[model samples]
Every structure is written in C-alpha cells, then in structure tokens.
Target: MNITKTDVLWNYAATFFKISSSVLLLPIILHKLPSEDVGIWSVFSSIAALVFLIDFGFNSSFSRNVTYVFSGVNSLLTNGHDTSAQSGGVNYSLLKGLLSSMRWFYSRVSLTLFLLLLTLGTFYISRLLNEYHGNKTNVYIAWGLFIAINTYNLYTLYYDALLEGKGLIRVSKQITILGHLAYLLVSTVAIYLGFGLIALVLAQLISIIIIRTISQRKFFNADIIYQLQNCEGDDKKDVLKAIYPNAVKYGITSLGGFMIQKSSIFIGSLYLSLSAIASFGITKQMMDITVSIANIAVATFLPQIANLRIGGNYDRIKAICIRGVVIANLIFITGAATIIFLGTPILHLIKSNTNLNQQVLLVVAFSSLIGLNSGISGAIISTKNHIPFVKPSILSGVATILLLIVFFKFTNLGLLGMAMAPGLIDLCYQGWKWPLVVIKELNIKFSDFKMVIMKTDKPA
Candidate 1:
C-alpha cells in the first residue's frame, strides 16, 4: 500500500525508454533501410501491435487479481473483488491457482495467435510481398523472427501481471528500461552493420527474452517458489472462471479503445493523401506521448488503488485519485502547450517528410485531455472490479467511426475532420460522463475535492 515518488519516476523512465526507443530507431531505419523495406517493417510493427491485442484484457485482469491476492483477499470473484473475507495475509494457494490458470490461458492463447499468424498472417504478408521490391530473402527471415518474437512474448506475458500485481513497480520499470535499452543498442549497432530488417526483429526478440528472464527471476525468488511449491489442490479451473467475466469485458474494452484511437489512421488513408495522414499521425503520436506521461502517477499507483479499495479506505482512495487526476491534467496542459508551439518547428528543422498541424494538435489535445480525465475516473471506478464503462466506451468508439465516415464523405475537413471526430464524439459523452460518474459514486463534494487538491490530506 506504500507508493513512492521513486516508483512514479521509475514508471516515467520506463515509459520514456519504451517510447523513445522507437523514436530514436526511426531515423536509423529510414537512413539505412530502403523506403520499401521501411514500409514493410512498418507493416510488421502494425501486425505486432495487432497481435498483442490477442492478450485481450487478461493482463489487467490477472494483474488486478494478483494484487488482490497479495493484498490479503482469500477468494476471487467473477464480477467484483473479494474484500469481505479477508485473510490478512497473502494467499499462496490462491496465488498458485491463479498462476496456474494464467499459464494455462496464455499457453493456449499464444499458440492460437501463432497459428493465426502462420496462416492468415502469412497470407497477408504474401500479398505485401507481391508489391515489395526489396531483398525478399531478408524480409522473409525478418518475418519469421517477427512471428517468433511475438508468439514467445505473448506466451511469457504473465510475468508482467505478476510483477505489477505484486506492486513491484520499481523492479518492473527497471526491467523495462533494461529491455528497451537492449533493444535500442542491439538494433542500432546491427543496422549500422547492414543487418537490415532482421536486426530490428532480432533486437526485439533478444529484448523480450531479457525482459522475461529478469521478470521471472524477480517475481519468483526462493521464498515465492517455495511457497507455491508447498501449495496443493488449488482449483485452477475455478480460478479461470472467476477471472473470465471481467477479463472478457477488459478485452472488449481494449478492442473498442483500438477502434476509437486508431481508426482515424485507417479511415484517413482512404480520404486523405499520405502526407495528410502522416501529419495527422505525427500530431496524434505527440498527443499519445503526452497522454502516457500524464498517466504516469495514475498508472504507478494503480495496485495501491486496488489495495485501498479492498480495505474500504474511501477517503484515501479519493485523495489519491484526486491527486493523480490533478497531476495528469497539469502535465497534459504543459505538454500540449509545448507541442502546439514547438512541435512543427522541430519537425521542420529535422527536414522531416511531414509536419504536425497545430490546428489538429490543438483539437486532439483537448480531446486527449478529456479522454485522460475520463480514463482516470474510469480507473478509479474499476478498482471495485465492476466495468460499468465498457458499453459506453464501445458505443463511443462506434459513434466516432461512424462520424468519421460522415465527415470524410459529407465534408472537406480532411485531417482536421479526423481530429475532431473522436473529440466531438467523446465530448458528447465519455468526456463528461465518466467523471460525473466518479463524483456521484464516490459522493465527493466540491469542498472534499478542494481539500484533496490543496494537499490538506495525504493518501496512504
């Protein structure tokens, strides 16, 4: 239940490393690889991202449940957390069962994803190869490595759940920094040596192995191993059942999120030129960085939030949430202002292919700020283990997509249309509703919020 400034800083470092590795690699990639090869690699990156959604919502579900078990909850529930029957100590048997179920689930899911990649993914790659004018042999080798990395990464994904669930934020962030550092170093050197696309995928594969290995060692030290080994007759099937409901909700929510956040790029490609899409994409990417940095404190304190929820410490929860939201907004506002004023000039200085549109950036910034607020409010509500926002999220996503189509066909807004579509749709519902939901659910008055914002009370 003890979160620290150090924990938050580590999380920020991890996020920076993870995001910057790709940013730093981009210039190298464009410089060394052919444009065709770079395009193909971009496709591979997209596919890798899509493949990761195969994890659905299980990671968060598993992590939350792990936190619950670690927080002294004796049993798992299908829809809500088990706060009533407290064990007042970690439940090794429950942990063992949950771990068993996680392994059983991920093993099957990863295998299924691999099969899908081998078959359907290969078919799609073949179509791309028809148009590809690169070194075919190297591309094939890269594709093989890409599939292996993704499949193996998915298989070992439970390591993430275990680490974050145990509130090992510092160690988890350390592992992230190390893994991404390996990725950046290996890929940079190999590309400079003319390894081409293979270098990138190979770097990623090594990074994943390093991360999973360290995570395994960190989470399963001698004491934990001994405790799990001594546990017996745990019902993994029951554990899976208990996790299934919320996990599926989380997975669907993820899909909706992808649709809301990413559909613009796909839809924009149809109506706008590549240059326009690229500009919009750059602006969106900057906004994404803003969002990630803004969420650092909230993400770092999530396990503690869940722990507080289990203890029924509503006041402390309110204080923590209020602080998290306040910090998030302050960060976002600063980031957005900097991007608005400085983003395009920097892109111009780099002699980039495209520039960020300040108008688009400003609109997306507003939308993203709203999204961040709603997201934090939703996260607070989720600590009770009830996913009330799923339907609204999905509906908002659908509405955004539909509105984008209308904008593309019925108006000449182009990239501006793309930025405004999600923002306008969100502003109508999710932007305001979720925060209101949190206020009502937590029964927070203006005075209480003011007190928390003024730092009159500290969250445990």
Candidate 2:
C-alpha cells in the first residue's frame, strides 16, 4: 500500500500543467472578448455544467470499477504465484477471464448511455433555446459548441480512466500538457483570425480530441481492444451493477450542485444587470480555479483509497482520509488569505475599469471558505461510498437558492449579501453536519478527525 513520491509528483504535475495552461489562456480570452460576451460564455458554461449532471457520475464510477478490476487481477496473480507455483490455478484464470469480459461489456454499455444522454441533452437545450432565446443564431452556434466540447470531454474521460486503471499517471500528465498546448495554440490563432468566442470553444474541443486520441493509442492499444470486444454477459452486469449506486449518487448530487451554483446568474439576468452578472462570473471563475487545486489532493487519493479498501487496508484508508482533510484545509486557508488581501488587485489586472462592490468580495471570500471547509468531508464521503450524505448536499443547493431570494428581497445588503449568503449557509452546514457524519456514520474517532486539522502531514 506504499505510494511512491514519484507518483505524487506525477499527479501534481499533471494537475498543475492543466491548470496553468487554462490560466494562461484566461487573460487572452478576457482581453479579446467584451464583458457581455464573457457573460454569455458564462451562461454557456453554466448550461454545460448542467450537462455534467446527466453524466450520472459515470466517470468516477467507471474509474472505480476499472481500478477494482485491475487491482483484483493483480491480487489473483500474486496469490496464484504464491500458492499455485507461478502458474495460475483454474479458478484464478476463470476469475481473470470473467473480469476481462465484464469490463468489456460495461464499457460498451457506458458508451451507449453516454451517447444517448448527449442526444437527449441536445434536444433539451434546443427546446430551452426556443423558449428562452427564441431562434437566435448565436444560441444555435452555442449549442453546437457545447456538443463538440462535451463529446471531446466524454472521450477524454475514457482515456483518463484507462490511464488510472493502468496506473500510467505520468503518461496522463504528458497528454494533459500536450492538450493544453494545443488549446493555447488553436485559441491564439483563432483570436488572431477574428473567430470570436466560437474559436475558444473549438480550440478546447479540438485539443481534447487530439489528446484523447493520442493517449488512447499510447496506452489502451490493440490488446485492450481485443479483450473488450470479446467480453460478454453476466460478468459485465455484476461490475456495472456494483457501480450503479455510486453513479446515481454522484449524478443527483451534480444536478443539485449545478442548480445552486448557477441560480445566482439566472436570478441576476432576470433581476440585475448583465454587467453585474459579468463581475460575479469573473469572481466565480477565480474561486473555481482555487477549488480545483484544493480538489487535487482528494482526487489523487481516490483511486488509491479505493484500491486500499478493496485490499482490506482499512487503517491506511483512515490515515489517508485524515491527511486529505488536513491538506485540503491548508490549501483553503492559504487561498482564502490571498483572496482576502489581493482580490481587488487581481480583479484590476483583468479589467482595469472593473469596479467591484465590497460586498461582492465578502461573498466570494466567504463562499471560498465554505467551499474549502466542505471539501475535506466531501472527499471522505465520496471515497468511502458514504453517499447518503448526498441528500444533505442537495439541501445545501436548495438553501442557496432560497437564501438568495430572501437576501435580495428583505435585505438592502445588495449583491454582496446575496452572494455571501450561500457561503455562510455552506460553512454552517459543513461545520455542524460534517462532524456528526464523520463520527456517527463513518465511525472515525472525533479526536482523530480533530487531530487531522491540527496536524501537518504531507498528503499521500
């Protein structure tokens, strides 16, 4: 159950390369596009986030299943060598063959579902555009862009999952770096040619498609394809069925989470100015970047943790959970401090004329705080398969919407207050609820959880 330092470095490098490339492009995008165009882009992104909900958490669920199968195969080989003289026993071969077949069948079914959902989503978006935007050509263009980007994203997930299964994270990192470079090159060219926002979308899609194709060739190869094609029947059902619950949990959580995150923009468009939405959107993007980094610690550990649990290394799993929480907090505190002190300067760099309400800063700061705090508990809950807590997460979204209404209606606190309310609610929920869940449901000692916050261990 030992994790090499090289593994951690490879994982971090991958995440950092991806984040850096996107960060580098942000300024170019903002500088070239108008504020209104940025707002429109935000709306498009918000809609795409909703499409993620339809993913039904298949990405994570599939990764978990893939990891389990790979780990199980390794375990069988080890046992076979130890007990059966290095040649696998009949039962070992049977299990290996069964798992291989099962993975193939599940992969086909997953691909089918992915395509079906994408079609349904396109139809839904088309209908929504008709009712809301009313035949605007840009809406159609936006929808096309959405489909292309999401299709590439779907394939990227496939390649990424395969890499995780093979534990070829260094290769994954290289693919990510190449993809980002492609995106930047395409976007720069598109901007130079006056291609507008569509250029940005196309750049992203093309880059992802290229990376996915290359990575698939490099890692998955012919033997994997042969195994998948030959797979069939009840074995496949078992793996798919095992993953279904987690997928549904993540899918529903994504739906509610997306609604909460996007409700403010929706409300702003209806009741506030487009400029206000633009300002808020910019701030949200900053927060998202920070959250994504904080999330890396948790994400890097998930496959390993799942493998550990499958291997019955519960003590190691518990230690990992504690370390993850502590690392998340450290990231959160540092990020929050930077935002509190430097938020205005950062915004000024992006748009010199951009004047933000002080309240907006507070809201953003508070929300970032809540986000960081909740990240610890959320990671544990997801990795441990304690998915019932997702109901509370859904409620957090509902609370965000209701609070926005009340804050805007009854308080004269303006946009900042409206924004800050969601953060406050999230903080309270994590502070109050996470403890009970960890102690009562997870059965981890409260003292151990507390020690995680106070201790400073490097994350595995």
Candidate 3:
C-alpha cells in the first residue's frame, strides 16, 4: 500500500472534526444544561476515559505490531530497530492471526468493560451525582448509553488497528469526519430539544456506529478478504504472546500518562465543588484542544516515523524532531497567549457554564507545553521500539497525583491546585527529560539543537 498526500490531509480533517465537535458541542451543552449537570457531564467524560483502561493499551500496541507485520518482519521484536532487509513483504497470515487475537481479546474485555462500567462505573457516577439537583433520568440514560458505546467501541477496535497498520489513515480520517459531523448535528439538535446530558452520549453512539461500520467496509478490500478467507487456525494466543511484553509496558506507561493527564479531574471531583469541577474541567479541555491542534502533523506521521526508524533514517527522524518541536512551541505559545488574553471573553460570548482565569490558564498553558514537548520527544523515541522512558512517564504520573492530593488538601489553592499539579510535576522531569533523551539517542550536540531552534523551515 502506498501512502498518499491525503494521508496527511485527511488527518488534519479528522482533527478539525474532533476539535470542532468539542468546540461546537460545548457551547450548546453549556448553554442548555445546568451548571451542576455540566459538572456531572464532565465527570461522565472523565469516567469514560478511565473505563477505557480496560482496553489497557492493546489497541495501540496491536496497531504498532500490525505495522511491523505489514513492514514484512517475521517475528515480534522486543527492542532496537528492524533491519531494512526485513521490509517489502506483507505477512497476511500473521495479520490474520493478529486479527483473530484482537477479536478474542476484545470479546472478553468488552464484556468486562460493560459489566464494570455498568456496575462500578455507574457507582462512581452515582457518587458524583449524589449532590446534583439536575435531571436524574437523563443522567441515568446517558450513563447507560455511554457504557454501550464504549463496549461496542472496544469490541470493534480492530477496525482502527487494521486501517492504521495498513496505512489507510486518509480513508480512516474521512470516515471519522463523516461520523463526527453526524455527531455534531445530532448532538446540537438534542441539546436544543432539551435532552441535556443524554444528548451528548446519544450522539456519540450514533457516530461510533457510523464510523465503525464504514471503517469495516472500507478496510476489508478484495486482497485482504482473500487473505483472511484463506487464513485458518486461531493463533490468538501466539499473537498475544508476541505483543504482550511491550503491550504491557505500554499499558503501564499509558496508565501513568493517563493518570497524570486525568488525575486532576478525578481527584478534583472529590475535593472541589461540582461548579469548581466544571470550571476546571472546561479549562483543561481547552488546553487539551490546543495541544491536539498543535500536534496534528507529528501525530499523523507516526506510522511513517515507525517505518523510518526501522530503515535507520536517523537524519529524517532528527528533522522530524526539530520540525515537531518548532511547530509545537510556536503553536502552543501563540495559542496560549491568545487564550490567556481572550479566553474569558470567548467563554462569555458563548455563555459558557464555566470560565478560566488568565493566571490559571497561564499555569496550564506553560505546563501543558512542557508536557507536549516531552510527548513530542516520546513519540520520536518510541519509533525506535525501545521504551526507555516508560518508568519516568509512570513516575511522573504518580508524582502529579500525589501533588494534586497534597495541594488540594493542605493549601488554599483549590481549583488552582487542580490546574497546577500536572504541569508542576511535568516541569520537574517529563518536560525536559524526554527531549534530552532524544538528543542523546540521536547523538545530537547541544549546538546543533541551538542552531535548529534558531533556524526556521517551512510551516509545519
């Protein structure tokens, strides 16, 4: 399969939709729902993210290994780069086995996620909602729908692995755009109809269904169908064994990363008022959107980066590092300033249920930028297939959570603590560490980085 220009273009399109859905959905949700209910919605979204821990990084790890199979590697490697000699053959049987492994894994995980979210997840939400005076019926209905959507999403997650592994990013992004449009349209209508929180999750259900169905049809073309049909035997266990080592590592790393990113929301809900959570969550969401917008190019090129690493193209990888950092810094710094200066006004214009203080958003901005830079470094390093920084990433999260607990409990910071915890810990290690590792790995000198920073290339 050949990569096309649209591969990158459609990725931007998909990001537009994702960010657009959030931006568009928010004004409506904040407008229609009560502040307390909005807080519950925030918690709901956070829990949805948490419940995905059940997938436990299988989808991403599977996708990366699937790329290896397609790259013509015969066996899964633990570390180091694959020699270029291994390229040029597509291992359809291995992919078939991987697909079988995916289905087998998802089946149990999906069931478990459903049961857990329906029980434990629901319990968590109920605890949050105990102080709510909003619409209980709608919240309950939305929770049920959220659970279902996640279950189905987990079950069919291989559609993503297949598309990404085959490097069909453009096609996948197009389908995603269509689904998100539907989500936006339906969700907007639902909110206008006063459906409240249920409206958001209901729209998501529709979008996921549309997106997954289209992906399944688009990916299983004639050649792939022929290969899968000819393929026999359930090699799920073999596939699991092949991917589990790094996959488990990635899971732990991801757990730490998720906690660092989300622990504020989770713990803040416990320590802060519902209204405070709403403000803090909304502010954090804005920061996330900024990072996502800044990250478009590098994120789209991840599979290609993997391919480059396997080919031992250190020069190209270094170039990507320079461009990614430059773009991320420029975008983040500009966006951060704009938001710091205008965020309150923008929130006001939309009649938002919550708003951000300049100081608070500023803390989040710089901290998030540092974390984003680390993320850029991590992305480049992981392309080399050895996760040397996994421990630091996990430790960073532990540190961030502990900081959050201490700040909220012992200080007068309150929502300010929620905003500062992740960023503060990130600055301590994650922000600077990963970039230094990348520099060391590539044998880059400090002067070269200085020149690279001073130089400007094409717009990322």
Candidate 4:
C-alpha cells in the first residue's frame, strides 16, 4: 500500500489496540486493587500529565518546523510558509540543528522534571497516602520508579517529533502498539500476581523502553544518519531562537488545556473520598478513549493539512475540517452511548469494585462531545501554523480550574462536582468559542457547514 493509506490504517489500528488494552486492563486492576488504591493511581496518572505543561510545546513546534525543513525551506517562521516558497531537497543543516536543539532542550527539561517529581511530586503523593490502607513503602518505591521512567521518556521526545514530522505515522503507530502490547502483558501479569499499583508503573517503564528503542532505530535510519552526520549544523541556539516564540505559546496552550481537563482530578481528590476519585477517574478515562477515537481523522491528517495549508488550498482545508468534525462527533456519540448503557453492567460482570454513576457518565459524555469538537477546530487551526487561540484557550482552561476549585470549596457536591465543573465552564468559552473562531477564520458559513455534512469531499 501507499504511504497515506498505510498511515490511515495503522492509525485506526493503533487506536483499536489502545481501546482494547484500556478496556481489558480495567477489569484486572479494579478486581485486584482496592478502591482507595485505584483512586490514588488515577489521581497520580492525572497529575503526571502535568509534566507536559513543562514541555512548553517545544516538541510539536519543533516537529512542525522539521516538516518545513523537509519541505526544502531554509528558515523557520512563527506561522507556516507560503506555497510559493516550496522548493527542492531537504535542508540537512536545519534538520540537524533542530535535532540538536530538541535534544539539548529536552535534556535540561527532563532533569528538571525528575527533580520536581522526586521532590514536589513525592510530597503530593504523601498527602494522598495519609488515609490509605496499602503499604506506604511499596507506593513510594513505585513512585521512584515512575519518576525515573517518565524522566527518561521525556528526554526522548525528539524521537517522536521526528517520526511524526516526517509523516511516519504508520511506523510510529505500529511501534506504539508494540510497546502497549508489552504494557498489557506485563501489567496483566503483575496485577494477577498481586503487585498492586506497583505493577502499573513497572509496566509503563517497560513499555517506554521498548517504544523508545524501536522508535530511535526506525527514525534514525542509515540515510538520515548519514545526512545528519555529514551536515554541519547551525547553532542550536539559533534554531531555538527561531522556534521559541511559537513553542512558548504552545506550552501555555498545553498548560491551559491541562488546567481545564485534568485539574479537576487534582482538586477533587482533596474534597472527595479516594473511592470517589477512582470512580470519576474511570468514567473520565473511558470518555477520554472516545475523545481519542474522535480525534483520529484530524490527527492522522495533520501532516497533510500542513502541506495543504502551505500550498494555499483553503478549500481542501475546509473540506477536511468538516469531515473530521463529523467523524469526531459520531465517534463521541456512539462511544458515549455504549459507555453510558453498558458501562456499569460491564464493570459488574468483571466484578470490579468501582462503578460509574449514570449522571456522572452523562455529564462526562457531554463534556467529551464539546471537548472533541473543540479539539477538531484546534487541530485544523494549527495547520495554519499560527496559534491564534492561545490566550483564549488558556483563559478557558484557567476559568474551568478556578470554577472547579470554587465548586469543591463552597459546595458539598463531591464527585459530581468534579465531573460537572469543567463541562459547565468549557461550554461557556472553549467549547463553542474555538469552533466559532475556526468557522470565522475559514470563512465558513452556517449553511456551508450544513451543506458540507452531505458533501463527502475527501481532503485533497
């Protein structure tokens, strides 16, 4: 098969593997671990995502610029280049510089994250451990391992940036599936053997190692290696200087998004019981799978979108955007219904200690719909290479977190508060605001949106 078709199939296949693994693992963990421990694990997982906030969007910004270099561009810009600027062969010097810069930046950030995780992260976990029934020492040991694994994983962000930038989505996804397979096998065995929370972290560490080793071997092939080595790279500082402005904007956007989507778990843990946190976490996780599924089309087409935008084909961009939105909404609707209808029964069948309430599930479902729609808009907007919604996006997330904090503090709404706060806040700003902004930017009319629903024009 050709590259695009290969990537599309592997992308869907990767998502299928992920959804399967997530569904399969829940039963083992929920049955093996106590409710409180499950909650603690869920909270830790949420907070660990905070490490991305430290990334400052450097990886993505760097990768996008990598695509430019590969497209024969000599210099980088905050936004993408014009179609007329497209020229000949890859600029090895720029590619070399970007790789060096990515490594240097990630090296420093990885160490900083390790320190923070060892110190502040450990302290946060300690607080959660106060009323827990599990062995404290085991959790601490797992925490140490987790910090080390994540630190090393963060250091290898360049591997992923390069692979995805080169549009090696099929290989990249295949590598990811292999790693997740290892994760499933190890975690399943560990949980079955009664390793508790430690098993999950251990499995993750194993998965990362497998993924990075394979990804590095694949991305840095003989030809790429010769090219990079032969080229005299520009100074890393120069490359960073060219990319930092947009990268920082992306970082702020990342932070704001985390605040909106994940801060609820962090704040909610303080007010609700650990069991409640676990329930909310599971429900949210299931919906997150739906969100991931919904995003497949846009994510798969990102590199193509970049090329199309640079070629000044706004019509194709519009067509792709409409189709992606439709697919995303349909995925979210179908996945949400299944989770709402079969979720509890499935848990019961597996003898899981935890359950998702229908009300919380409904709220979570609605939020996923909006979040997925907004995400589609954001991904489309990103292809333009300008991050116009950075401020507004961050503001929406910050507002959501603040509202969640207030809800937790003043009211006794408990777990429901955690699920509902972001939904309410996001709908007011990011949920609708981003799509509106996207439509305006694309010059898409309401009637155009309606008409495109049936148009079935594949992105050129």
Kindly report which residue stretches of model 4 are placed more than 4 angstroms away from their true locations once superposed: 1-3, 82-85, 445-460
TM-score of each: 0.91, 0.79, 0.94, 0.96
What digit string (tens of lDDT, one per residue) describes model 1 on residues 102-156?
A: 9999999999999999999888778667756768898888988998999999999
Cand. 2 Cα-lDDT: 0.62
* Pairs of colliding residues, candidate 2: none
Candidate scoring better on TM-score of 1 and 3 = 3
Q: After superposition, how far is residue 79 of candidate 1 from its true place, in Å?
A: 2.6
lDDT of 2 by residue, 1-460 (tens): 2345576677677667676766676676677766665666666666556555655676655555555555543222211111222222123333344345434544554465457546875565454444342234755675577676775475446556667645666677777778888888888888778676777788888888888788878865686656555643234345456556777787777665665566776655555555566677767766776777776666677777766755556666666666666676677678766766786776578763334566676677667656665655665666555465568668878888888788778887657755776676676565457645654644577677665666544223
Winner of 3 and 4 under lDDT: 4
Any residue pairs clashing in model 3, and if so which?
none
lDDT of 4 at 61: 85
The candidate with the higher TM-score, 3 or 4, is 4
TM-score of 4: 0.96
Q: Is candidate 2 or candidate 3 better by TM-score?
A: 3
Candidate 3 global lDDT: 0.80
